[model samples]
Target: MKLYDYPPAPNPRRVRIFLAEKGIEVPTEAVDLRQGAQLSEAFRRINPQCVVPYLVLDDGTGISESIAICRYFEALQPDPPLFGKTPLEQALVEMWSRRAEFEGLLAVADALRNSAPAFKNRALPGHDDYEQIPALVERGQRRTKRFFDVLEERLAHSTFLAGDFFSVADITAFVTVDFAGWIKLTLPETHINARRWYETVRARPSASA
Candidate 1:
């Protein structure tokens, strides 16, 4: 198996950290997002979506989307059980994972993509370019702050995003929180629980990946 990746991108980082936690090492080819390498015809042939963090199986089947790739690995190696251990656990993990992606990651991404000058006409990710919406940028900033507050409250009672055990929910949340730095958004100093959880997760070896 091989992974087409790009360092510094939060989506790819999610898969990289998942692979690290599972102790799986697959050959990787870096895709330079900043240089628009993903838009090249060569890369478009592998993934017409023109995105990073695409994985190709041994059988030559290509997989896009970070979460889908992580799910594939989870099925391949179940010892660590990053997704969940049981039926109920899996449901809860999925719930929290979706929240982390929608309320957290997407908020930060919207703000960054629409506000950052570098992403001027490329507000959305994909082969097609989209213009930034000023209103969306403001809305995104507000939503991002609300998401942090929600995380702070949730972490105050639960050790992890979904439950006591660290799962994909935590991984998704961690990457989103870290990515928030790009938009100058962060957990408030008063959010002690969130800060504590962030620090603990950041100390993990997989977090460094």
Candidate 2:
């Protein structure tokens, strides 16, 4: 398998952590999104949508999007299972992963795309370009705060985002929260459970990936 990667992006970092946790190291081709390399014709052929973080499996099956690539890795290496060990656990992990994708990742994207000067005319991740709006930045800030609250409430009760075990949900939330500074957003100091969870995740071997 070949993974199209970028060094600083959170989405790709999630995949990196997932692969490291599962002890999977597929050959990789770094796509420099900062240089707009993903928009080139050659890269577009790999993923018609032209996104960084594409996975080309050994069977010539090209998978785009972080979550799909994560699932592919999970299926290939199920030991030390991040998704789950049982049917119910799997469902819970999926539930929390989905929530993190929308609530956590999307909020970060909103904040960055709407606020960053470099993303002046780019709101969505793909090629479509739209004018940035300061109002959207404000809204993103509000949304991030809401997500932090939701995560704090959830973490206050459970050790991990999905359940007692670390899963893809935890990785997703970890990267999103770790990069919160880019968007001028942050995890609240009063969110003790979330803070504790963050510290543990920081110590994971996969986290350095």
Candidate 3:
């Protein structure tokens, strides 16, 4: 199996951290997003979506989405379960993971992609180039601020995003929070619970990946 990855990108980092947590090492090839390598014909053939963190199974089956790739690995090694152990636990993890992605991660991406000069014509990911929307930048900024409050309330009661156990929800939330730094967004100083949880997760060895 081979993992096509790009460093420092939030989506790819999620899978890298997942691999680290599972103590699994697969041959990895860097797909340089900054240089538009993902847009090449060769990469497009591997993943029509042309996204990084694309995983190719030994049989040549390709998986694109970061969470989907993580799920594949979770199925291969179930001991240190990152998704969930029970059915109800799995649902909870999925719920919170979706929330983290849509509410937190997307918001940060929208703000950064639409407002940052670096993104210019590449507002959205994939092979196609989409122009930035100034309106979305303001909306994203507001959503990002609201996301911090939501996390603060949730983390105040739960040890992790999904519940007691550290699951994929925590991973998504961690990456989202960290990625927000790129847009100069931050967790409020008053969000003590969120800050505490963030610090604990940041200290994990997998976070360095």
**TM-scores vs. true structure, each candidate:** 0.98, 0.95, 0.97
lDDT tens per residue, model 1, 57-94: 88989999999999999998996999888899899899
lDDT rank, highest first? 1, 3, 2
Off by over 4 Å in 3: none
Output the TM-score of candidate 3: 0.97
Cα lDDT computed for each candidate against the true fold:
0.93, 0.87, 0.92
Model 1, residue 18: C-alpha shift (Å):
0.4
Clashing pairs in 3: none
If ranked by TM-score, best first, what sequence of candidates would result?
1, 3, 2
Cα error of candidate 3 at position 200, Å: 0.8
Q: Per-residue error at 162 for model 3, in Å?
A: 0.8
Which of 1 and 3 is ahead in TM-score?
1
Q: Each candidate's root-mean-square deviation in Å?
A: 0.8, 1.3, 1.0
What would the per-residue lDDT of candidate 2 be over residues 1-209, giving only the tens digit for each residue? 78999979999999999999989888888999887788888887788887878988779898888989988777877887999888999999999998988888887788888877777777777766678777877777788889899899999999998899999999999998977778777788999999999999999999999
Name the best candidate (by TM-score). Answer: 1
> After superposition on all CA atoms, how large is the RMSD of candidate 3?
1.0
